[model samples]
Target: MIHFKTLKQANHAFMLLIFILSSLFLSACSGQEQTKQKIPIKDEKTKETAVPLVKEWKMPISISADQGEFYKVIGWLSDQQIFYVTNLKQSSHLYLYNLITGKSKLIYKTENPIVNVQISPSKKYLLIHSSPSSNEGLVTIIDSKGTELLKKTFPSYDLDFEWNPYNESQILVTKFAEDWSFQLNLLDTKDASTTVLHFPEPFIKWINKDEIAYLNWNRNSPSLDAPLSFNGFGTEGEKTVFANIIQFEVYRNMLMTVSANKQDKSMADYSFFDKKLKKLFSFSIPQLSNYSDWLVPFYDYSEGKKQFITFKPLTSGDADTYSEGFQLIRYDLVKGSSEILLGGLENVPLSVSPSGNAALMGNSFEKIIDLNEKKIYDLKRND
Candidate 1:
């Protein structure tokens, strides 16, 4: 009887342990299933969505020059056509390329270095300026197909030139002087007669056909100097003055200029006259260490859609890495910021088509990137 009772108790204990073990295993599986379901729900929205990526072209050219070698894409006529000049070119020749038809031509080849090339607002004329080593500089106007229309030689050096959007017949050319002196010349292409506007110093800008903005400095104590005043010229050559100013720019009728140079290397000013130059403001850039590089392009705001292009050096690393390379950034002034339209290009010569639907880009390298779609459209190999 005792043996039987002991066996029965042992069996009951074994049955109790089995029941507990099965319950624990069931709980664990249920917890695991709950966690798996939660994870999918948390990420369900993202799993169904996609993120866009910025596409870029591998520009065709590989640069071999050391630091300080001069290279930049100066002008682009269209997405399929481009104009580029290099210090290495024979006299920095301006070469033209049409990528669609695979035809390239040397439009203007000269021994004198070309400082700048600009296409007229109408896209009918290309203005090329040559700064010779021996002779004074001259402005050469040519047709798109490489026919020379006319050439005008300056009495002194011309630092900058711009074509008027309102009138293709009128061009504004700046005659820069040593020690911060300059003059403005209005050249009529049709008649080839130049009208000179004498400014006491470098001008901030001409706001319109009737108004011009220029700068002036103050001589404070023998070595110390402060800003004195800002001046404006009216249609009939009338003068207006603003005191204690440094730098300025004019858009439409509004003028804004720099009043203080405490932190910024550059600032812009403009005027408010017959009409207002809206969106006119100025500020200085903060510095990195004691070294910084700044590039300022002459702003064009006369139209609804304006073009802004310049060679901006990379400021993050050693000059050796970037001296031979530069990026071309363009802004639709109507729109506020610049978009990375092209890269991996040397001497970015750009030309926008008359219809504004297409543009042409050329560099020392054969590949040209399309800014609108961010793709490689042309790859030209040198013979």
Candidate 2:
């Protein structure tokens, strides 16, 4: 009877242990299932939402020197064509070069020496200014296909003209008198109409389609203390925007100004103003540094972003004689920060692409810099 009771107790203990282990295993499996249910699964849409990298491009093929003698670059007519001028012994010729095919075709030629060339913003027309004699100047408007549109002669000694950015048919011409005073005239190519304004200073630029900004000097005040005002002219007449502006330039809807310092003549404050005449930001630089340095607007403000590219001189001196190098810096107006793009550059930039993605450096061997990619390319002629 004792041996049978012991065997029954051992069997009962073994069954109890097995039941506990089975319950623990079932609990562990349930916990694992619950954890998996809480986790999220990735879908195809999530994988497709990643942003692509910016596109990279190689430099265009260089042109050979034997093709044509290029003196000055007028501008880029398109991404593939470049307009340039060449001065021969008795004539000046304008040529259009194809970047891909490495071929140049003469578009316009002038018997008189070419003084200045300006192209319309639409790239459909070009204004060629030439001086037939010391006191005689001729302005001709021509299409890109070498067809002449309009020609006018000016008896004045100094003649300068600029095409209206917004209007392909309007042009602004300045005629300087012998006394250094200038007269501003608006020329309409469509109707051959001309309007003379009372404004004297010719240092003006188009602010928009209908508005122009120019410098207005307060001659009533003392010569040394005369305040220079930034004024806007449109169909509504004239309006003063800012006072004591020493130098200014308008880029798209932004205006950059250098105001004279009354307290310190050796220093000046550079300021940026929006289209509504609201001050955005201001910084001070030595007056001497302004001569050797350059302030250029980088990207446009189409998407509400403002930035600038500036060249800071490593050493200060007269701009004409300064031998020191410079540092290229990019400044962000919103973040109020700056980054150095390049340093120890011996030459200043000769020209910048319209998109602001590239710049041509005027070094001993001219080089083109890809501003977005931070790459430099040799702008030499391919042999």
Q: Which of the numbered candidates is closest to the native, going by highest lDDT?
A: 2
Encode model 2's per-residue lDDT on 35-120: one tens digit a residue: 77665434444565542211232233344444344456676676446677777775888887665455778899998888878878
Candidate 1 lDDT tens digits, 127-240 = 988886433678889888788888888856456776765566778787765553678788888988988776555444555554445545433432112243334443344354
- Those runs of model 1 whose alpha carbons end farther than 4 Å from true positions after fitting are 1-72, 86-92, 155-158, 177-181, 216-275, 278-383
TM-score quality measure for candidate 2: 0.68
Q: lDDT for model 2, on a 0 to 1 scale?
A: 0.66
RMSD per model, one decimal: 16.2, 10.8
* Alpha-carbon local distance difference test for all models: 0.53, 0.66
- Candidates in order, TM-scores: namely 0.51, 0.68
> Which structure among the candidates has the greatest TM-score?
2
